[model samples]
Target: MKAAWYGENGGPEVLHYGDIPDPEVGPKTVLVRVEWISIEGGDLLNRIHAAPSSDHHIPGYQAAGIVEAVGNEVTRFKAGDRVVAFDWNGSHAEFFAVPEHYAYPVPEGMDLRQASIVPIAFGTAHDALFEYGGLKAGEFVLVQGAAGGVGLSAVQLAARAGAQVIGTASGEARLDRIRPLGLEHGIDYRNEDIAARCREITGGKGVDLVLDLAGGKGKDLLVKALRPHGRYSVIGAAEGTLPSFDFFELIRKAMQVTGISFGRDMHTPRVHQLLEDLFADVASGALVLPIEREFRLSEVREAHEFVATQHPFGRVVMRP
Candidate 1:
């Protein structure tokens, strides 16, 4: 199998594409011929040693592919099945092996390239909004970094659930892309104060839920934009700073704060259920994964470089 891997953690230059040993499938694993792999910030972090590191690591978590072979113990799928899998490394190769439980069947008629984007960004958005935040219809939701991967998914998911969605972006072009995804209001954080704009949009009641992916004093900003008993979910920190706030504010407003980290053990039946729901939405033409760009496997380094420099409107995928 051909793969792009790093023997040591450093920069994008460390990624080298060449022949690597094919993954040996375990009894509980399934071998997939990867069609498309989504490049995420987490993958970049792992490559640069900002996140977890492993020697000779192949970095990629979400992929859409066809099941080429199955293990003896695997019962959920067989050869030729089109599927999407989440949280699997080594997807930066022609073939990869993943546990059967982590794989989900892609609905018929859905583009595999688009379906590839759902496992991480869309899954995280669904888990944060419904499972963690307990979002209700007719409520107000605000998504920070709305132009990025998970942020765009959150915007659409929140809107699909009947919540009025507000988003924050850095420029007008990015905001314009977010508008058709059901964003009712957009704040240009570079030109305007996010908290103030959000407060004005809600008429001072604040939003019922706040998804803060850009950390900093944004925690305090979310607090200001959150209504009483609001739910605040922290998913990422692209802004590079941490802020402090008074504990009394939380007690007074009865607000809830949660930090979400993705891992192997986080899988549950509810996650499977949400994936099913999201796929159904996609099948009905209600949900779509906007592919901002695509790169070949050999251009993996360039893909990471692009994502690092420019904040794209949707996901960047690599066809391996």
Candidate 2:
């Protein structure tokens, strides 16, 4: 099968697209003919930081495709079923072989392109907001880097759940785009002070929850924006600079910081039910995950580079 892989960690330029051995499907595995692969933030982070398990390591996590083969033990699906699959790697290829537990059946009427982007982004946001963050209706929630995939998902979910959603984007144009999706307040992080705006928006009471997707220098501002004992959901670090909370800082506010890893729960009944509902929402036009850009598998380097530098609104997809 054709794949984009690398022998070592580096930038998008390190990726090489060519022929690679087809993954062998095991007893509990499902082989999917890849249609769309979502370029997640973890993909870039893994390319630059995570060690490769093999000499030729394919990097990606989420993809939607048709099931070409199913394992002997697999009872949920069979050949000709459309599904979205997730794994720590091997999604950047023509055929993705994953355990049946990691595969979610796409809704009957949804496009493969849209189903490909759902699980990770929506699951991560759902867990961060409700499962870990303990968000309540009428509370104020601030989503940093709100224009990205997970960020947009958080804004929409929080807003729909009745939380006052304050989102941070690079500019007015991007912020304007998501307002209809349920952003109650927009903060142009480039030109506005997030903490100040949050304080003002909440009438001197800081936000009840802060979803920090951009984990660089902006972290302090998010910390300041949170009210005492507020929940801080650490989901991703788009800027690549992770911040550590000091002992004094934690004590001063009695804040709760939770790190979200959606993959950990992908096989659980809770997440399975969550994805089922999410898939239905997208298929029925109740929820939306926009495709900011699309590329072919051969342009792997350019696609990864565009995701890192272009500040894509939702997700960047690749066809194989």
Candidate 3:
């Protein structure tokens, strides 16, 4: 099968597209003939920082396609079923094999391109806001990097749940695009002070919760934007610099810091149910996720570079 892989971690230039051996289907595997691949933040992070587990390591988190085959042990899915699949890696290929549990049925009539991007971006945002952050209606929740996939997802979910949403993006145009999705206020991170803006927006009490999607130097500002004992959900680092909290920083603010890794709980019955609902919501147009661009699998290098440098509003997808 034709696929993209990198021997070592670095930039998009490190990625090479060629034919590699098809993955072996295990007893519990669901083999998908990949149609669309979502370029997740973790996919880029892993390529840049995580060491390859193999010389032919193919990196990606999610994809949607027809089930070409399924293991004998797989009972829920059969050949020709449509599914959106998740795994630690290997989505950037012609065929993606995942455990049956890692696959979610795409709603009938939903586009594969749209289904490909739903689970990770929406599930991660949902978990960060309510399940872990304890966000309540009427509370002020600040979303950092609101233009990205998870950021946009958080905006809609929080807004629909009755929370006031404050989001940070790079420009007025981008922020304008996000406002109708239930953003109560928009901060231009490139031009405005996030901490000061949050204070102003929340009447100096700061936000009740902070969703840190872009992790980097801006983290300190997000920390400051939180109210005392506020919840902080650490989600992603689009800036490519991993941020850390010192002991004093944590102690002084009395903040509750929770690191959200949606993948850790994705295989559970709880998450499967959550994803099923989310997929339906998306299919019904009750939820929205925009795809900024699409590329062929052979153009993986250019796709990765565009996502890293262009700050795509929602997601970038690839076709096999």
- Which candidate has the highest TM-score of all? 3
lDDT of 3 by residue, 210-313 (tens): 99988999999999999998899999988898999999999898989999999999999999999999999999999999999999999999999999998898
Which residue ranges in model 2 land beyond 4 Å of their true spot? none
Q: Can you tell me which runs of candidate 1 are displaced by over 4 Å? A: 7-11, 48-53, 240-254, 262-266
Clashing pairs in 3: none
Decoy 1 TM-score against native: 0.90
lDDT of 1 by residue, 123-148 (tens): 78877788778899998898988888
Question: What is the TM-score of each predicted model, taking all chains together?
Answer: 0.90, 0.98, 0.99
Q: Spell out the clash pairs found in candidate 1.
A: none
| Candidate that scores best on lDDT | 3
Rank by TM-score, highest first.
Answer: 3, 2, 1
Candidate closer to the true structure by lDDT (higher is better), 2 or 3: 3
Instruction: Write the residue-wise lDDT of candidate 2 on 132-202 in tens digits.
Output: 89999999999998899998899889988999999999999999998999999999999999999999999
- Of 1 and 3, the candidate ranking higher by lDDT: 3
The lDDT of each candidate is 0.82, 0.93, 0.95
| lDDT, residue 112, model 2 | 95
Better of 1 and 2 by TM-score: 2
* Pairs with backbone N, CA or C atoms under 3 Å apart (clashes), candidate 2: none
Error of 2 at 234 (Å): 0.7
Model 3 residue 111 lDDT?
92
